[model samples]
Target: MKAQSTAHRVSRTLLFHVFTAACGLLMVYPILWLAGSSLKGPSEIWRKVYSLFPEHPTLENYINGWKGFGGVSFTVYYRNSLVYTVLATAFTIVSSAVVAFGFARIRFKGKNFLFACMLVTMMIPPQILIIPQYIVFSKLGWVNTYLPLIVPRLFGQAFFIFMFVQFMRGIPLELDEAAQIDGCSRGRIFWSVHLPLMKPALFTGSIFSFYWTWNDFFAPLIYLNNPKRYTLSVALRSFSDPSGLTDWGAIFAMSFLSLIPVIVLFIAFQRFLVQGIATTGLKG
Candidate 1:
């Protein structure tokens, strides 16, 4: 009976692993395909559409893609992307944390009403705000500049605010009290006491902000017209021309390269992401 039970448990575990492996492969196949296609010769890209790996595996695509169009190379676009991504991400997370800390810990008049208003902003579609925002930026002479992309994030993002507030509430109030007894002000308590403990949520928010800002195409497209100022997302779109030929291999190569930062970030900080979501909004 013991022998039979051991055999059954081993078989069940093996079956489970096989099922999960299959699901993981299905999800990862597109990325695998993109990597494979990026190595193929331009002609071979379309000729062998279903091939998993390139026959020749030439680096020609990477070479051409790096050269970019105009006088500007892809490195310039990468720099632009990095600037926008890093600045916007920092602003978003910091602002969200500060705003969330206030909403969670501070009690003042009209707080509930203000919280409700912030919640309502999240439900409004971003497309609705685009025209009005564009006009305002244009009037300020901020169009075709990085200011439009970077400045708006100085204000806290609604989604991150809510997430941080929920995460903050889960922290013990005892810490705040202890810090107060030690002659720490609210700012000091937040900085020295709570900030370190809020690592999981902060890391999670930073990762999210990085991903969203790095991949954002719509805002960059609307605000930026200069080729030199274009981000990777916007610059990649320029590779296609309806009136002429498009370089599929270069597109694939750059596209895959652009995904690298996001992938690396997730792999590095995914533990925090999981922990942040898991522990948020529950009292000890």
Candidate 2:
């Protein structure tokens, strides 16, 4: 009976692993297909729709995609994207951490009310704000500029602010008390005591901010008028020909290239993300 029961457990575990592996592969098949398609010749792309391997794999697609349009290359698009993403991510991280610290540690009049309002903003869809925001930015002569993309991030992102608040709450209040006993002012405490200890949460916020800003399309498209100022996301869209002359191979190649940075960043810092989220949720 003991041997039979052991065998039964082994069989179940094997089945579980097999099932999960199959499901994971299923989910990843599309990405695999895209990567495969990117290497195919333009004529062979549609010809071998179901095949994940190219009969004549070539780097020609990447070469063509990098050449870009209107005398601009993908290099310029990458630079524009990097600048926009890095600046926006930095602003979000700084603003969210500072605002979250106020909500988590400090006591101020109307603090609860203000925090509640920020929470409400999270519930509001960004699409609803676009029209009004465009109008405001237009009136301020901020249209067709990076200012429209980067300036708003200077204010706290409600989602990141909330995440930081939860994570900050997980830190023991004794740290603040101890810092005070050592003659540390509030600003000094934030700089020396809190900021260093908040690495996990900060890293998590940064990864998220980087991904969102890097992949953002709508805002850049709406604000940036000049082709020279276009980010990777916008540039990718410009690669499309509405008259049915689109370069599928080149498009797929660039799209695959765009995913690389995001994948690398996630793989490098995913541990911190998991830890921060787990600790924050438990503590909050």
Candidate 3:
């Protein structure tokens, strides 16, 4: 009876793993198809639409895609995206941390009301503010520039601020008290103690901020008028002509290339992101 029961458990575990593997493959099939399509010859793509493997792989798509339109290569667009994303992410991290630290640790009048107001902002859709933002930026002559993309991040982003606040609250107050006892000013305590302990949360925020800014299409589409100023997302869109000529091969190639940075960033920081999110509301 013991041996029979053990065999039954083993069979159940095997079936469970088999089922999970099948589900994972189904979920990942689209991405795998995309990757495969990027390597296929344009003529073969539609013909072999159902096939997971490419029949005739070539580098021509990548080469042509990199050449780009209007005398601008993808290199320029990639550089612009990197600069825009990095600066925006940096500003978001610093600004969010500051605001969150204030709300989490500092005591002041009207703090709760202010924090509540900020929380309310999180519930509001960004689309509602786009018109007002556009008008304001246009009046300031900041349209068609990276300013429209980067400057808004300098102000505290409500979601990031809330995320940091939750993580900061998980940290013990004893550290702050000990720092104070050692003659550390609030700023010094924040800089020397809180910042170091907040690495996991900071990394989590950085990953999110980088991903959002890099993938942002609407803002860049609205603000940037010049082809030279286009980011990867916008440039990728230009490959499709509404007149019915679309370079599916080149689009697939560039789209695959555009995914590299995001994939690398996520892989490198996924550990910290998971840790930060898992521990967010837990007391240390």
Candidate 4:
């Protein structure tokens, strides 16, 4: 009876692992298909739509995709994307941290009210604000420039601020008092005491900011007009002609390349991302 029970438990564990592996493959199959299709010849891509392995794999798609349109290589678009994504992410981290610090640690008249108002902003859809934002940027002569993309991030993003605020509140108030006793000013306490402990949250926010800014197509589409100023997302779209002559192989090749940064960023900061989400408002 003991041997029979032990065998039964082993069988169940093996079944569970097999089921999990099957589910994981199901989710990852599309990405595998995309990678395979990117290497496929143009004709084979459509002809063998469901094929995971290409009959004729070639480097031509990547070579042609890198050549880009109108004598401009994809190098320029990649540079534009990096510049905007990095600067916007940096500004978002700094501004959101500052705003969150205020809301989390400071005590003053109307503080709660102000924080509540900021929370309300998060409820509003970004799509609704696009037209108004475009109008304002147009009036300011900021169209066709990175300013429209980078500048708004400096003002503070509500979602990041809220996340930071929650994380900050989880920290012990005793740290602030200890810093005060050591003759440290509020700013110094924030800089020296709180900031170090907030690294996980900051890293989490940075990952998100990087992904959103890097992948965002709609805002860049509205603000940027010159093909020279286009980011990777916009440039990728240009590869698809509305007249049904889309370069399927080139699109897939560029799409695969475009995913590299996001994938790298996630892998690098994955530890902090998990910790940040799990520990928010739970520490102390």
| Per-model root-mean-square deviation over C-alphas | 3.0, 2.5, 2.8, 2.9
Error of 4 at 211 (Å): 1.1
Write one digit per residue (lDDT tens) for candidate 1, span 1-284. Answer: 99999999999999999999999998999999999999999789999897879999999999998988888899999999999999999999999999999999889899999999998998899899999999999999999999988888999998899988888898999999998999999999889977898887888888878888999999999999999999999998886555557688988999899999988988887887667557654211
How well is each residue in 53-102 modelled by candidate 3, as lDDT tens digits? 88878988899889888899999999999999999999999999998999
Mind giving the per-residue lDDT tens digits that candidate 2 earns over 216-254? 999999999888999999988888757757888999999
Which 10 successive residues of model 2 have the least lDDT summed? 275-284
Q: What is the C-alpha lDDT of each candidate?
A: 0.89, 0.89, 0.88, 0.88
Error of 2 at 148 (Å): 0.9
Evaluation by TM-score, superior candidate among 3 and 4: 3
Tens-place lDDT per residue, model 4, 1-284, is 99999999999999999999999999989988888999998779899898889998898899988988888889999999999999999999999998898899989899989999998997898889999989999999999999989888899998889999988998999999998999999899889988899987888888878888899999999999898999999988886656656688988888888988987877777887677657654221
Name the weakest run of 10 consecutive residues (lDDT summed) in model 3.
275-284
Off by over 4 Å in 1: 1-12, 276-284
The lDDT leader among the candidates is 2
How does model 3 fare in lDDT?
A: 0.88
Q: How well does model 4 score by local distance difference test? A: 0.88
Give the Cα error of residue 21 in candidate 1, in Å.
1.8
CA displacement after TM-score superposition, residue 160 of candidate 3 (Å)? 1.2
